[model samples]
Target: MSAPRIIQVASGKGGVGKTWLSITLAEALAEMNRSVLLFDGDLGLANVDVQLGLSPKHDLGSVIAGRARLDEAITKYEIPSVSGAGGGARFDVLAGKSGSGVLSALTKAEISGITRGLKVLSDRYAHIVVDLAAGLDQGVMSLCMPGSTTLVVVTDEPTSLTDAYAFIKLLSIQEPAADIRIVVNMANDREHAWRTHAALTNACKNFLGLNPPLAGFVPRDDLVRDAIRHQTPILFRHPQAKASEAVRRLANDLLLPVPRPATIISTSSRK
Candidate 1:
């Protein structure tokens, strides 16, 4: 069996659709027949449950306090069919605590325990999509330091670009080996996305000496906001939406493994 891949969906600025990407990416992976887990990593502002209209009996708080097991905080979610079909994608959510005080206050031991819990549960799912808290806080950076695929979402705004660069620079300083990915959200068009990625990558390369790849981008679409308002992911609620289509394509590229070319020549003496 393949090892579980932890995909960390984070943003430099808030309101960049990180949460939206997290949920939809998990669903897309599940639809591709991969067991996926959408983890809410923002303990202080946990809204994944709210967005999904789920009230979990237990959450990360209970797990942190030893009142419940890690698995106990998990709740299953099945995305509604887009084509009005009977079947749809299903994934699990490890709900975080809402209004649970500042996440920065989480003790070192507590964070360690949470990390262990995640590692233990990793084997159960093919992909773990972590919805990390916005900004570059210590707690958020700690969780992202491991070999997780980090996708930094940014908008076209100046502040968004600046903060995104800062986030990547800090990550590069700490973990120079980390391969960061960029996804431009709310772009005007494909060219806008490419330009945004180019600007960010150029800054990182020139200053931080890091080269983060541009994964994909989602154009500005009112349907995205509509889906958010309805508390449903755009991919499921309106698959035809431009933003949803981009997200689906992003999911496919990330989850689907590319095949290597054939004809591997042997190094040893050939006949």
Candidate 2:
């Protein structure tokens, strides 16, 4: 079987809606008939399960601690059809143990183990969406392989732009040929989104000499906040919401053929 498309969603800072985008993007891809697994790569303080209102008995910590197999920790989430039809969207989630501190002290060997597990699991699904931890920490940098697409989520704030540049600068140095793309979340409009994208891209072009293209942008929508508050995916909670529509478009763009071969991360080599 062919290798799965590994899309790593990351950000320079927290509170930029990185996890939310990751969840919805996975759902959107699932809706397109591709089997997807949303792996919460935020090892230190994961909240993907909490945001989705899931109470999984097993999590990443279980696998790391030898309490369960990697596959055993997976929790399946399904959205029933509103019209009572048989068809609906569903995807699997490999949740992380929130506030467990297991990730904080994880050795390189343990990280490599998780990376190998993901490679083994790649055969079963067409896509693996890894929502990485915020900032350019070891956890985030280790998982950013060369062959996978990396979507850097940023907002209109100056701080967001600065930190995003820092991430891109480092990633470009580490994986010079990495497929890095920009995603503007909480944008005011298309124009506003482009401006935000330009700020990051210009900085990259000038300093890093690399211009990451814009993957897409999500508009600032109140419904997004409501969905997060209720621990429901925006696509399921408000299918007609602007944010939901934007995510669908982003997913569609991602479905296009990747320009490079798919490869897993080598955490051991990341210094």
Candidate 3:
């Protein structure tokens, strides 16, 4: 089978709704009939399991400790169709080690091992959404594959814009032709979203000599909080919610073909 598209969702700092976007995006992709796996790549301080209300028998901790195979750690999450149809979206989640800081202290070799495992597991799914830890730490950057599409989530906050610029700058240094895209979350409206994008775009173009295209924007919605509290995806619990609609649009945009660099590094090439 062909390798699955890896969507690495990242942010400069926390509390920017990065994890929520990762979960909803995975669900949206699955709804489009693609096999999806949401890999909680946050490692230490992971909360994907908490957000999804799942208690898996195996997790990344088990895999890292050699107690379980990578595939064995996967937990299936299904969302029944809101229309009461028998068929709905189903996806797998390779949860991270929650409420523990041990994974954060992993050695470089250990981090590479997990990346290798993910590459092997890529063959089983059509797309893998990796929820990266917030920041530019070594652990977070190590998992950022060159062939993956990097989505940097940002808000209108000044700190968010500044830190996002720092991240984009460093990522560009690592991979000059990296496919970095901006995702504006919790915007007031389309105009607000574009303005936010323009702010980041201007900074990148002026300083980094690059202009990362705007992937999409998600408007602020109160229902999102409710879905989080319920440990269910907004697309599943409130399909008609504004946030759900925006996420579906983002997912659809990702499905469209785009030019990629010829020097794109596949997982097999990683040492």
Q: Please state every model's RMSD to the true fold in angstroms.
A: 6.9, 4.8, 4.9
Clashes of 2: 0
Error of 3 at 76 (Å): 0.9
- A best-first ranking of the candidates according to their lDDT comes to 3, 2, 1
Clashing pairs in 1: none
Candidate 3 C-alpha lDDT tens digits along 55-121: 9999999988999998999999887454745347889999999899879988888889888888888
Per residue, candidate 1 scores C-alpha lDDT tens digits across 1-271 of: 1232888888878888888888878877887889988889885587888787678888887787778999988988877554645347789999888756655579766777777778788889888999988887887777673766788999888888888998887776566556578999989999999999888877776666566777899999999888878877677788799988888888877755643212112313211
Clash number for candidate 3: 0
Top-scoring candidate (lDDT): 3
What local distance difference test score does each model get?
0.78, 0.85, 0.88
What TM-score, over all chains together, does every model reach? 0.89, 0.91, 0.92
Model 1: lowest-lDDT 10 consecutive positions = 262-271
What lDDT, from 0 to 1, does candidate 1 have? 0.78
